[model samples]
Every structure is written in structure tokens, then in C-alpha cells.
Target: MRGRIIVLKHNTPGLLRRIASLRRSRVLQYRDAKGVILLDILPQGQCINAARYCSTLDRLKEAIRRKRPGLLRRGVVL
Candidate 1:
């Protein structure tokens, strides 16, 4: 089944500060046709698999923590 890709852009009003930041963050949320969250694309280009068949939010966060140690520290809340 083809899923819908939702890109969550950072809504912070500081355009200059966002550009000046070292890491250009991007969050992509994938959902199925029924509106169920499948997975998420985190900053630093990491994909967190949160599909209904496998994996959960906590597991995904742990995976992210392992992949990018500095991501959580940068104030990016998943």
C-alpha cells in the first residue's frame, strides 16, 4: 500500500538562525491510508521505523539515540 509522506518543517520564526544552525533538520512522518503512523525521517537523515507491523515510538527513539547522539541534544523533540 502506498503511504502518505508528511514533512514536518520547523515552524520556528527565526529564518536567519535556522540557516545559521550547524545542522539543517528535517522531519518526515509517514502514514498509511487509514491515518496510522508508519515511520519518521529524522534529522541527520535517519529513518525511524514505526510501522504497525513492527517497532514502537520508544524503540524508534532508542534507535535514533544510538545513531545520532547529538540529535536529541540539539533540542529536536521527536
Candidate 2:
């Protein structure tokens, strides 16, 4: 199966800096032909670097094992 990674950005406009701190988060998703395989929400100000990506992939592997055990045996394309 082939999978895709989607980055969803959530933005709020026009907030008073003094009154309230700005809040933002990023949604990271992994989906295959069937449906969403894994989803993660990154905390505000976090960036997607090698270390983070590696951790996310580790989680993804666990998810795959739990959700679709046969996928790994069949081989997957990312």
C-alpha cells in the first residue's frame, strides 16, 4: 500500500498580543488507500526536523503494526 503525509495548518487572525497569546498547532497525518493510518498534532512552535520525523515514524510503525499487520509483509510505499 502507498501512504501520504499531509500537513494541516491552523491559523487564527487578528489577536491582540497584549491581551492573549497566539495559539497555533500543526496536524500531521498519514493515510493510505483505505483511510487514515496515523495522526499527530504538533505543539505550538514545534518544527518538523530529522529527530522529530524519526520519532513520528517510530510511532507510525507501531500504528501500522496495530492497525494493519499484513501491510508490512506486503511492503508499503511512502
In candidate 1, the residue pairs with backbone N, CA or C atoms under 3 Å apart (3 or more residues apart, or in different chains) clash, namely: none
Q: Residues 1-78, candidate 1, lDDT per residue (tens digit)?
A: 123333334433654344335254443344334342333334465554556225556655675566555657979655
Using lDDT as the measure, which candidate wins? 2
User: Which portions of model 2 miss their true places by more than 4 Å?
Assistant: 1-23
lDDT string for model 2 (1-78, tens) is 123322324322432231123245556678777777776767688889999999999999999998888888887645
Report the number of clashing residue pairs per model.
Answer: 0, 0
- lDDT on C-alpha atoms for all candidate structures: 0.47, 0.67
What's the TM-score of each model vs. the native?
0.30, 0.65
Cα error, residue 9 of model 2, in Å, equals 20
